[model samples]
Target: MSVKRPNPAQWLWYAVGGKLPDRYREWVLHDATAPTWLVRHVIRRLVFMAPILAALYLVLAVMMNFDLTIVLVGLGLGVYAGMYYSLIFSTHSVDSRVTRHGYPDQYASQVRKALKQAERDRYNATWRNGGATSR
Candidate 1:
């Protein structure tokens, strides 16, 4: 399938966990399976958080009269806790996202394993097949 980049509106929808149209299937697959997928996912998640965080900052620091520094630190801690769990469930998250876009279950993981097969084979040959470990 050919890769077609989603427009900004589609990307914003995607960032907020909305599914893209069928035309973006290949892009979704590539986005979830590419080498930089982890970083991309994190960035996407963070983008989704931006507006919420801004609203939170306004509520805590402005309306509630909390100290700006304290509010910022509190928000930072909240983000840290969220990111911890997000990373832990990242694989499942990606798989779900890809599936929501109409791909098969675990398609990203399968693609990644396939993409690395040659490199994995080389590593096994070097380490397990007496290339250097046997010495």
Candidate 2:
């Protein structure tokens, strides 16, 4: 089934662990060959992450009596640390998600790789097409 194209708002939802509301099983989650799949996934994850980190930083700042400089430093350190750790265990996260969506666990890597290639191709295609990225 074809999914209705998601609006920017829905994409934000997708970032936050919500399943793609449309064509999730057939396209976004399963096909892995869609041009924007890899980039789309990464963007979604990052979108999901921003608010959480902001909340963390806010709480820390409040506890520290609103020291903006210290909060910034801590936020920077937290971002770097979070990125480092997420990379180390990214596969487990992907595999678990894939499994949750009913795909075989072992297919996780393949799916991701395909999605990456598709995104690359799409990006190149956009450059080739007069710098206009079509949808």
Candidate 3:
């Protein structure tokens, strides 16, 4: 048995939390300790789920004849629920993974703090540079 590897375009989908490879997960948990990392983590989950939400809307409203307004409301609620779950679960997963890799549990909080500080510094730098920041 063999697992098919995702091509370049599909890599983004995996990065969004579709069973991230252990190597990548380790790298993220260990090396990427910046506030933007958390932001990107949340973005990845949201982006990964967008297509699922769109398909749900199409199925409910177009194929199943549900009202469009109801479908929209349903998707909105679903997204909110997903956001709540993803943030908590994703963080916990990273923390556990780091601990499994031999780091102490407290290291997880340290990583988060470093990420927050990095984000704050970036914001301040952008502000100092005339409020123009490139990606």
Candidate 4:
């Protein structure tokens, strides 16, 4: 089934770590526990950063009359710091989001763990056992 997703504004609010309405609850659960959830989460974070970074650049360059080089350097440092901190709390943040959506705590983790078990089993079969297996 095609998943019901939020509108652009709702998505942006979600990206900004704001809570979305109940109508988009299923979409939020799927987003927090999809097969590529981690990558998707990282992408959402980058999406959240882009606009903020642009605004920061604008404020520094225009409001403060700073040089382009200084603004760029500051933006670069900010991006690095933002990503480092965001990633450090990636799982915690995602889990918290799931709970906020009315799911039990660590629900995303449990779902992802079950989803990954098949892959782990295949890896163990292919390499851990032997390169060649009886069919």
Which candidate gets the maximum lDDT versus the true structure? 1
For residues 1-135, could you state the per-residue lDDT of candidate 2 as single tens digits?
A: 455556677656655766664345544454343545455455655676789878877687776577888788877887778667766666666566556656777466776687678888888877975586678
Name the lDDT value of residue 6 in candidate 4.
Answer: 90
- Assess the local accuracy of residue 92 in candidate 1 as a C-alpha lDDT between 0 and 100: 90
TM-score of each: 0.86, 0.58, 0.57, 0.81
- Between candidates 1 and 3, the one scoring higher on lDDT is 1
- Cα lDDT tens digits for candidate 3, 42-101: 776778788899899889999999988989998999989998887878666556545654
**Model 2: clashing residue pairs?**
none
TM-score of 2: 0.58
Model 3 ranges off by over 4 Å:
1-10, 16-32, 96-108, 114-135
Q: What is residue 134's positional error in candidate 4, in angstroms?
A: 7.0
- Ranking under TM-score, best-scoring first? 1, 4, 2, 3
lDDT of each: 0.89, 0.64, 0.68, 0.87
Worst 10-residue lDDT window, candidate 2 = 26-35
Local accuracy of candidate 4 as per-residue lDDT tens digits, 28-125: 88998888777878888889899989899779898989999989998998888988898899888899998998999999888888878978988988
The reply for model 2, stretches above 4 Å from the true place, is 1-5, 30-42, 60-64, 111-135
Superior by lDDT: candidate 2 or candidate 4: 4
Better of 1 and 3 by TM-score: 1
CA error at residue 26 for candidate 1, angstroms? 0.3
